[model samples]
Target: MREPADVAVVGTGVVGLAVAVELLHRGLDVTVVGPRTGAHQGQGTRAAGAMLSTFSELEPQHDAVRAGMETAERLAAHQAYPAWLERIEAMGGGTVQAPSGTWVLAPAGRRSCLDPIAAAARAAGHSVEEHDASSIPALRAPASSAGALWLPTESRVDSAALMEALSRAVEQQPRATWISQSATAVSAGTVACTEGETVRAREVVLAAGCGIPALLPECGRPLGVPPILAGRGVSARLAAPGVEVEQVVRTPNAEFACGAHLVPRTDGTLYLGGTNRLTLDADPAQAPSLDEVAVLASDAAALLDPRLGAASLLDTRTGLRPYTLDHLPLIGRTGDPSVLVATATYRCGVLLAPRLAQLVADEITAPGSLDAHPYRALRPMPAPRIDDVLADGAAQGLLEHLLQGGGHLPPAQQDEFAAFTALALRALLDEGSQAGAAVRRLWERAPVIEAVPALFALARRLEGVR
Candidate 1:
């Protein structure tokens, strides 16, 4: 066995690096292993928007997986920015400029979608201000709508500066060793490097972003992994020609645009994003999809001032965000206590890093300080139904619906239908559960009338399957 360190953290994204800094702050010997430092290129924090607004993201749509998100724990991460940013700057690291305010907009006279969002913010003690359309910024054409709800507390930080600062902090630590090598495998406390070296420690922290499931099999735990789905988000940086907005301006659920989001950087570049597609098996080395870029640009032009059409383009970037079937982030220890996990925060990874690092660090060094129920690592992951793929945290709800007669066909054959449904669905999940895209693909390949009876017969004839 190689020499064991106090702690070995895998992955060098913001979360992993933050954990290293926290552990070192507490006087624990630490080693951070991942590509950016030496391994290869673990892309995550670098491509993040680093928005620190849980209040802005308080859509009750995901209440099933991540309940109590508005509670103190989630806010702790976003709240740590003020103090943490100061600490980073004190170490000679550059600053992350967090502009004040964010505008959540809706189409003309269609503010109904925002009612629940506004109500949730008030219930969580956050402030929301409504603005009249006449006084709002003159966004050129289609994108310009009546007015918006001003989320004064929801702010965004420059992610590039934050990551540079974090990298500096991690490097400055005397007890933290920076290892640059792709971790090919991990078992117990030992991580097998692609460079033919095995590094071991007493405990390990896996913060490998979307690469979590890949390393889980190597960890010697056979309790199955949450088949993580990767959503590729693309962003374009541009200079708004005539736009006169000081705060981050965003739209709620723009179908034409991915997330229908736009942000004006401190450096005068309007950051327009983001196109999300399921990149389950796609290679990240490929360039950002041009189709996605075109749609985003088109959407921005329509949603904002027509002058956006004349804006200067700076650069385009892409990052694969790790998403789970339930949409809830995994943050606690895994089935094997030796290997703790923190991945699947999705778009909120950058915002949640600081507080999540503190919580995970405390869990390792000082256990029981934070409740693990909300972030339990090894709970049974629910499969997305064919109709509602990617449970969106209503796994239990879907199960209860099936059991409570939500969509049973005929009463005469209800029991057989339910049993057959249960058996066939279980078989489809044999290899591993998948996200919605696969089911959609299957439907496209075969006619529903023919495919239905075919799959049913196949399920019924399977040997030794109860």
Candidate 2:
């Protein structure tokens, strides 16, 4: 180990970068180590709508109401969202923008779907207006759709630009340094890098997404971190012709995959995304299937505009969001004393970074300065059973795939599987396409998987003969 600084942040995604910048600005010596796309680029932070939609991400009021002010806490979090975005923009010199409000739609027949959301938003005192899908030409609400609600205050961030801007801004800080390397192991104040460098720091922040739980054991204090899983998502970017979309649009229900949403970049490119499936390998070299891209594109085109389907395919990107057992972010120190946990913000990482960083930095400089966040590393939430997870939609295909050759699978189902296999799973939609690859790598890499007995039962149900 050489030149141990005051702080070492072992990740460069939005959360890690934000924490590093915050600490540096707080007058602490800081060193950041993570894989780099180039001399100054980051992974994981890419591939997102970068929407700072606080209310949009919340569960409906029905659940909140039933939980008895359980959501009051989330509303408090929402109140601080805008301020955090402003803080980040100030650091990046206005590189990120929440240019316009976000519009959410419920398929025509499902208008009722917007109720709980609207209720929650109204409870938060945010103005909400309900209207038919036709209200927004961009959403192209089908007759089947129930309608939608618009939250003009909800906004999107230029995720790619913000990421680049953060990297540059962080590197320019006199007290901060960005080291391009993969961390092999991390403890309270020491981080060992794959590049054969050992960094010693006064304290360390482990914000490496799914890698958090995996690395804790390697650091000799695995018991301090909770079980965290990874949700892999695929998104495709399209080049919009003529006037580019000026607003964000999304479906009310996403059924088996992540929700269907569209985000327009400042440069006029539109992003149609994304699909979520359980994956262990956060850095898989695999690419999204053309069929997967088409499904998202076609859905967006149907909702937003016909031009979307005809748009040029610019590129596709993938990101693995870290998920906790309770779906809340785990921030703050662990029993390991010096190890501060800041990953697991999941889909809200970019939008919530500024505030989260502030909380982490406050804790670091003055322990217990900020009250504890709802998510704690040592919480007693039990991990979910793998079988209960299997039946979850969009991922049902994964379970089906795991039980192959139960000759009980109808001839039609087998024929369908054969078709996709012949063309390399091209026809499988949602998680089906990614299921095979994920299963093959399960024990080798997947962070979460269901139990074996459930697998056998599913297989038995699928097979005519064992």
Candidate 3:
């Protein structure tokens, strides 16, 4: 038994730490649980490229409400980051090394994809400047490259440094307790850990990311929390001897992932990222595959610069990104008011941390503040329309295939292939659930097909209730 605290924050990833720090700053006694080694294989914080991209991450959403809510959250985080970073630094968290601005480029044939992205950014009041692909300094754009759009507001930080700073800030807080152990269970006001240790608190927040599903059943009461899957993303660091870029450069959002991107870090290294494979097993010890590494390298060379192929691969990292059925974050308190959840931010966890932390803290300090909030935990998650799913799946599937050397196909053949893909996706969705022939045939190739199981489950649950 341990002394009770005001709040017990489970999980030590970026969001967890951010929430703990926010609560502590508000004069609350906090006990932070979860391992601090920063070596968790699925930990998103440390393995992140840490892009503060509000506009660069945008993609067309089928659901208007979901899109509006997500845009609002992203804009709020973008606005809050400067002040939030200042406050963290004031707490001796160390200055974060974040390069300003980002360049979003489209491959030659894909130039049209940049239109909606640029339009969305401009609509959101962020400045978008057009630049000739060849004129972009330090970039060896392929001869067939389309133009580029420079978002002056987008930024990125050194993920490792940011984590160190957050951990240091929490450690130095007098009212904060850092428990370097995994939390096994949580009751209304108590959290149980390995070795039989427990910490009682007035409120318990489950920001465990992919670890949430395991602990949900152990809660003293049913949380009615939605299903969360692990989107395992593999990224690598490279030492490109003479290759240098002053800004973050990335492609627009791809099929089931944030397209390949390069972040120039303060340590004179480049971060190459953009692979996502959703899995049912959220194993923290999962290893990055050689195929993932090779694809990342190949993407960098083909999409950004040919010189990157020779860059020394400093290391590879794997992070499990938590995502819900509709691919939106779950924030705010659950059905059990004393229990709150703030996970499933997916690719935007790093970008949305500050805003999410503040939202969580506000709910704790002032109940009912978030009663009407759109992202309130335990909200009904209806299954997305099957037609929309098939269409999006086919589009993304074709894009993925084309990127992987299918671009060499003749125009007529490409159209035929697209039709085949659409039909294939429709057939897969008809098979029902993730374990069916759908997952077997398209799990690795098509990203959207991964959500079928959860969608079917949600639809069935909703139907039963009706």
Candidate 4:
């Protein structure tokens, strides 16, 4: 292998790009490997609207609250957007007009959800105001929401534009390289890509979403160090039809879990999103059911005039968000000195990128600088029993396709399925007196449901059944 470059980021998604930019700015040679030449131009980040807020009208939690505070503070102190904007204009890239604040709206019935989040936000050192239905519309136009809370510090960015600008900015730096290829595996200090290139880096970061845990062998972490899983989100983008809301609007109780966010861009484009679909593969072009679109449209029309609805839908897309089994980001270095795990930021990837990048870069450059306890590579958690996993697969429809649809199993789910099938095959292969009984038990208990794809996957896992 060639001598190690300063750093090699295995994915050029938002987190990968952000870390590369931070490292390069700190005078490190960096190479970004991904299918795209641009940073953050991959799936989810490219489709996101870059809403930097701690509180959500739909669901508020401590992770986002803390992450949001850090992000807001950093953006304000570093003037991150201004620096990004300058680069955008220089590269003839577009701009996203960020309002001075953001608003979280609640439906009449779901007002109770606000109390916990609001209290948490206040404790986190942010000002939160509770407004009646009347004040909400006046605070920002098209305010038909039942109630609203204004966050003065929250900001939004044009995700695609920022990604493009970041790509250009990094390219302008002589030490930065963007490799257009997918990494096949990792060894010692080098990452092998499908393009017949092996890059040796002083340090390697596994920032590939959904694919993180699978690369554990190369990350120098345990095979299953991170038990994180992936969840899918789909979004739609539309042209802004002159209906301006001074802040990003989030509605709860809409058809989509978080309702829809209407973020008006500086260039008059409005981003309307989105929905959470838990399946493994969420292709962008997958058309959302009419039911989903209606919910988003209804939410947007309530916030703005119906004219905003007059705009045509520009694109529909989906992103696979890396969700930990416990729903927190996995950051910090592993026992392996050369490898780092930075996956499972889930929905907060964009909001938490700046600080996360800092934490990651620090861990890479100075692994001994901090206690790696919370983020250490050790997995104290035990792998759930294959029986329990099989039940979950049944619940998640891992076997339904084999029974009803005849669909193919997803590759990621195949591992868990293999474990399940091993148990069933063991029973069958045992050749004991009760082997027939085991088959009946498996059949009776492993039926697939309509919603869970994992069940169908589990059924297929019984590949060596006697």
TM-score of each: 0.78, 0.79, 0.90, 0.70
Candidate 1 vs 3: which has more TM-score: 3
Q: For residues 50-157, what per-residue lDDT tens digits would candidate 2 score against the true structure?
A: 876656654332245433343454444456656655665666535555675777877533456677767777877778998877787544455555677888877777
Q: Model 1, residue 375: what's the lDDT?
A: 61
Candidate 2 clash figure, as a count: 16
Q: What is the lDDT for 301 in model 2?
A: 60
lDDT tens digits, residues 241-357, model 3? Answer: 867998898887766677789998887899999888667666778788997887788788888888998999988888998887767788888878898998889899988999999
Q: How high is the lDDT of residue 302 in model 4?
A: 50
Give the TM-score (vs. native) of candidate 1: 0.78
Question: What 10-residue stretch in candidate 4 is worst by lDDT?
Answer: 398-407
Could you tell me the lDDT of residue 307 within candidate 3? 91
lDDT of 1 by residue, 1-466 (tens): 4458888899878888778877887889887787654322326566655656565565445353243653455567757878877776665565767776777766553466466557656776888888654445645434336566877777788777777788888788777777778787777888888888778888888888777767767432473456566667777788876786667776664221124566777777777775565554636565676777776676566555556777787887777777666666777676677788877776778778878788888889776554545666677665545434222322322232233211224544654555556455445645343423333344343322112332333433454343
Candidate 1 displacement at residue 70 in angstroms:
4.9
State the lDDT of candidate 4 residue by residue for 1-466, as single tens digits.
5556888888766777778777876789988877764333226787676787555533432255445544454444234545545544553444535556776766534466566557656765777888764554422434334566777766777777677766676677778777788888865578888879988887888788776655556433354455555455666778754555556776542221344577776666667874554554434345566755665565556543456567788876566776554455677666666767676676667766766677777777777643543444454544343455344443223332232211335756755665665455445434554444444454343221222333233444555563
Worst 10 residues of 3 by lDDT: 438-447
